[model samples]
Target: MNNFFEVENVDFVVGGNTKVKNMSFSIEKEGDIVCLLGPSGIGKTTILRAIAGLEKIKNGHIKLKGKILSSEKINIEPENRNISLAFQENSLFPHYSVEKNILLGAEKNPDNKDKKVSFNEIVDLLDISKILNQYPHQISAGEAQRASLARSLLSKPDLLLLDEPLSNVDQSQKEDIQEKIKKLLAKLKITTIIVTHDSYEAFLLRY
Candidate 1:
């Protein structure tokens, strides 16, 4: 049988240069975590963006659970794709508390009756219960990253694209966060693709 998720011959261009040229890969099972590793400016993040529908693909296609998401003839809107992307910059709402910020994601996906976890379950799973009332700037980089992750996972996305998930965390906290995230992804069984420049971090995320 074929894999549950696939990216076939995807080509992405930024400016005039080709970033991801004919890239292809797949995840064979649910709850599997995959990592894309490369040097800076080598299109790792670009691939994730393309898979999440944030960037348009110039060629080839991306499929989730055997459904086509992007191609030359068809393109699905980001929100309608049941895909979520969490970037390295920590795109949290400074005006909203952590709980409120995450709640927004859960609200958007109310149509998804397949969601197996509740909002409070996600917050507790991410260990952000203590900082639920804190604003973005009031929390540490690690805390902010966790909150952003919680927001993404709360939606119970079919595909989770994490661009440098630990980039905002301190070096000392990378391993702990990576382990926690790995466990949570496995528990939730949300197919995930992670982009990272650190080889050690990639190794730590091994299933």
Candidate 2:
């Protein structure tokens, strides 16, 4: 049997600089959560981008469920990869309400309508139901982060990538939010790879 997901001997280059080199990792089963822990500028985000098909890898291969996603001779478009990436920065459309932004993700696959997570469930878990009508500019950084996360989760992707997922959360609520997210992921059983600089966060969400 093939591994669920694999990144082997990958190298990333940008602007004539080598960002990452010889990186290799694998997720052996579905619903496994893997954390890529490192400091800023160390290419953690780059790795996520590469896996998501947002960036090209200069060497090696990325395979999902035994299908090649990226390689020297082939690069799949991001939309065709069945992967959702929650960016480190809030990326909601400026003119769209929070609810609309989240809905966009689910709209990607009409055939998976019944499989999508309930809107209310995610908003309630992220505590963003009250701000459904609010735009991204009107919410706090933490709120925006949660909204982005909600969108990603609603997409029902085969693989989920979260970049600094809780970086903007307030200190008092950070731990609580973390616990809620952990439980939510477990309940959903979505295969995930989280990128973060926090060791504690990595440990809490570790496979």
Candidate 3:
């Protein structure tokens, strides 16, 4: 398969001991949704962190669409990577209003002056128009999760990394959010990666 992502002969070590040794893999092709399935603390999120330029790799390289995203030889910064990430917690700005956070891309990026999903459209899609004026704390975890997804989409992400995006939600609330995620992701149609232990949620993400 043509690769959208490629990690070759990579090795990373963090903290005093956490290490991923000689790891190599690739996304099947462009638009392929893949997951790194393992128990917690298995360097799953670390892998994503490496890909997102949030962490530095000790060795080897990461290429997205044939452009090097990261490597010890050439480390690219996170903002320059075109990768939007929504981790389980601390994904949104607590100080900014939901509308403001969603439109941050347009604010930082003048080139996106004509994005298809305008601020209003994103708020409407996530049913967050009511909370557009609310801070991250004012909304429910589920609502914030949805809003975070919307914000990521608004960035026109080249690759979207969801690090267990729904882990903070209650079990009963998970399916609803999971469905919303599937629908929203399907609409956005980008190269998406989900980090989670929920097999059911994984099934829902089986696009």
Candidate 4:
């Protein structure tokens, strides 16, 4: 049986240093959530970047739905990959309100008729409705993270990659937000790969 997503013997190098070497993994089916869990600065994020087509792999193959996305000779552009990546830093636009930032994701493909989730649904799920008008600087770090996630989900990506999604969330509300995100991904049946340094988070998201 073919896997839905596969990364085989991949190497990712940056600034003349090899960050990830000979890594291999796969998500066998759609709607599956896979976590890359390890200590910080161990190339977990690089793997996600490779899969999302943001980083070029030095060797090996990254495949999605039986199509080769990246290899020694083939590198697909990030925009053409139909993948959404939510950065760890919650890279929201400083000038735009939270609502506008989130809406930008949906605007990527205005002609797409089969949206997996609506704007209201994502806002409600992530509990960011109250802060829609607030700018990224106006909200807490946790709120910014959720807003970033909301934007990624709204894009209706074939593959969603989240980088340390809940890292900035308070411990008190971390699990709650994780559960909500897990359920939302399941409901939408989105194939997801989350990069996290916390084993507990990996367990929560994967199982």
For this target, which candidate reaches the highest TM-score against the unseen true structure?
Answer: 2
Worst lDDT window (10 residues) for model 1?
108-117
lDDT of 2: 0.89
Q: What is the C-alpha lDDT of each candidate?
A: 0.83, 0.89, 0.76, 0.89
Q: Tell me the TM-score of model 1.
A: 0.89
Q: For residues 154-184, write the lDDT of model 2, one tens digit per residue.
A: 8888899999998998888788878887887
For candidate 1, the per-residue lDDT at 43 reads 90
TM-score of each: 0.89, 0.95, 0.86, 0.94
lDDT of candidate 1 vs native?
Answer: 0.83
All candidates in order of TM-score, best leading? 2, 4, 1, 3
Per-residue lDDT of model 4, residues 1-207, tens digit only: 999999899888776678989988999998899988899899888888878888788879999999999999999999899899999996999999999999999887666665567899889888889999999999999899989999998888889999999898889888988998899889878899999989999999984
Counting clashing residue pairs in each candidate, in order, gives 0, 0, 0, 0
| Model 3 segments more than 4 A misplaced | 106-115
Per-residue lDDT of candidate 3, residues 3-72 (tens digit): 8888987886676454788899887655567766668887888888888988878777899989888787
Clashing pairs in 4: none
Off by over 4 Å in 4: 110-115
Instruction: Report how far residue 169 has shifted in candidate 4, in Å.
Output: 1.0
